[model samples]
Target: MFGKKEFAMSVHHRSARFLHHHPVAQVLTVFSFWLIGEALVRVLGNPLPGGIVGLGLLLVLLAMRRISTLSMRRGAGWFLSDMLLFFVPAVLAVLDHPELFGLTGLKILFVILASTALVMLATAFTVDRCWKYLGDRKEREHA
Candidate 1:
């Protein structure tokens, strides 16, 4: 039992080292998926944005075990950790466009609220549907 525990710990340590060694590789892996998504959009002329499509493709790959998040987690986490930095540019742009605040301020606020609510509803519905489907599958499997 002790030997097995030691081996498992060693494996975990090695995996951690592997992830740390080439952190940029993880970011590139993600970017490659996005590029592929963009290419697909250009070729297929999809109405959806390439970045969104790429994100969905990444999800599918992760779900199918074709891609592992192990290496990507650190890089992705770093990006998320400093996420507010990304909004700086957009915030600055809005600040520059002070004219937009004069006549269209309320309109922009309304649109932002409406879009946010729509996104929340859509996300909630998708999560509920997926949860139900998975729960039903588990029941069928047990039955």
Candidate 2:
């Protein structure tokens, strides 16, 4: 018999409480990871990516509980759900690279195909593990 207000308050309370407790540390930690990601990309002359390292660093924090699931939950969940939208800008670059596509398109296609496969596999594995971990946590909550 819970009303909408109760549901909303509960959600708001969780999000607020998480933000309140570790606001500064969370910001610093994320900033550090992203900075590392940026530095890795620039210093290493990354062909594939740079921001991925920062993401892995954040993943490490999640595993260690330096950041709680609730704290990361909101941002990561939102990002993953709408991540495609974020790629629009990158995709637009293809329009400017029409000549590259026309002349040596096969070479680019091969690289793209391989990289896409790798990325898909990696994302699947990560998402699967996270789902299982969360599922187990829910089961324990009920038990």
Candidate-wise lDDT, in order: 0.83, 0.75
Scored by lDDT, the top model is 1
Clashes of 2: 0
Instruction: Return the TM-score for candidate 2, rounded to 2 decimals.
Output: 0.41
Candidate 1: misplaced stretches above 4 Å?
Answer: 1-21, 100-143
Which candidate leads in TM-score? 1
Question: For model 1, what is the C-alpha lDDT against the true structure?
Answer: 0.83
Instruction: Give one digit per residue, the lDDT tens place, for model 1 in 20-131.
Output: 6677867776678789989999999999999899889989978997557886887777767888998977877877788778768888888999999999999999999999
